[model samples]
Target: MLKINLQKKLQRFTLELDLEIKPAFTALFGPSGAGKTTSLNLLAGLTKPDSGKLSLKQKQFYSEKQKINIKPQQRNLGYIFQESRLFPHMTVKQNIEFGFQLLTPNSRKFSFDEIIETTGIVSLLERSPAALSGGEKQRVALARALLASPDYLLMDEPLASLDQPTRLSFLIFLKSIYQKFNLPILYVTHDIASVINFADEVLILKEGKIVGYDKPMRLLAQLQTRPLAAGEDITNIFKLEIIRQSKSRGITVVKSDKLEFVLPHLDLETGGELLLNIPASEIILGITEPNGLSASNILPGIIENIYHLQERVLVEVNAGEKFTVEIVEATVERLNLKKGTPVYLIIKASSFRRLS
Candidate 1:
């Protein structure tokens, strides 16, 4: 278990953390300046807290009262930042070996071949960092981190620079790494979509305080009742079974327990499952169904609840499954939508992204 009870006085707010983390995938989610990164820094020994205690598996990393502070190198943690931060002048292999070379033979846990093969960077070992793509550089960074054989992993928006598809692919690989290594991960991000199905537990931070902690769906359900932070994107995730496929029509039909929708052509077998992502902002709520529409997905349901943000509103509709839709205030008033009102959700086929 990883325990943290720390306080740091920043210029704008006093960061306070009181949490226990198990050996699983835990996400630290918040908007910008919410102190997500600060918390990671404190745990990694990069920043000192004003006062508190930090420990992992009963090993004391920091103790203000005891006057004990461990150096970053001695903490045995793998920290991956948004940037790959690889040495540009060195080859990928050399960069990855930099840390491993420092460790004595007794301290090494994984062989170089095993780490490179697991990270899928064996072929790119001889290439320089300048020659690697964004994904490739991140792969090398991950390989380098794994070579050190840290007790736990700290990721600070590691997938922020990648595109949506790349992010999805990298996350899939990260999940495999997590399962294979059995290492606890502290993933920090401002984007909720990245942690929907990936995080075992999510910690919501606001103004340098731990505001909420729960599973992804529970926290997301609770978040619908209040206003979201600035630039926060609420992404809905669903794993639906494939009903049929039409290659000539360029579409695939999928169904949940209560709703069936058409998505763009996916080269997957029928009856197999595919994970889908649809952002709240991408959905449009209609009072009634209309004809001659381009979008193929039109789900009808009753508005179970409504929340008013500053300029936008989030409406929860129960259409076989719960969906949180975002719309402007004017649209809500023009439609005269309220609790128990019937509404149609319109979504474009192109708006859906496959997670797996």
Candidate 2:
């Protein structure tokens, strides 16, 4: 476990944090200037706090009163910044070896070959930083961090620089790394979509204060009646098992713990999983069942809550698995939708997008 109780006085506001992170993927979610990066810096010993304590597995990393502060390299915490921050003078192989050489053989948890293979950067090892693309550079950086054999890893929007498709792919790759190594990670990002289907628990930060911490679904449920963040759409993301596929029907069937979804056909194996993203704006809600329609999926549920956005209203529906449906205020009033209003979600089979 990692414990942190730190206070820092920044120009905008004072950052006061009290958190206990377990050995799982925990996300620090917030908008710009929420002090998410500052919190990570404090934990990594890159910055000193005005007061408080920091410890990992009963080892003290910092103590303002005790005048104890561990050096950044000595903390055994790997830090991946927003940029790749690789050395222009070195090749990818040399850059990765820089971190590996810092530790003795006994301290290394993974071999250099293992890190390169796991990150899929073996081919790029001889390439220089200037020759690598955004995603490739991030992969090399990840390999460098893994070679350090750190107790915990800190990622600050490492995928933010990648394009949408590359970012989604990297997210899936990161999930596999977490599963394979079972290492603790504190991932920081402003995009809720990046963490919705990624993190085990989300720690919401607002103006240097910890606003909420819980499972992603439960945390969103608590914020159902209000906007979780400005200028961000609420999307329902799920990782479901592929129960079966119908090549004849051109459809695939997948199921969550409680609900089944019919999606457009994909050439994937049975029992494999797919990461699906259902945008709130793409879902249509109806107060009554309609007759013949072109849509393929319709789910019955009650209106759990309502949130009023600047232009559109977001409705929370409990259809076995909770779903967020977007609609306009005029439609909400026209359909007489409120808490406990029974409704059906109309979704086309092609509306589902595969993230991984």
User: Who wins the TM-score comparison?
Assistant: 2
Model 2 lDDT, full chain set: 0.87
Give lDDT tens digits, candidate 2, residues 247-312. Answer: 998989999999899998897999997888788889989988967988889999999878665556
Cα error of candidate 2 at position 121, Å? 2.2
Give the C-alpha miss distance for residue 167 in model 2, angstroms. Answer: 2.4
TM-score of 2: 0.76
Number of colliding residue pairs in each model:
0, 0
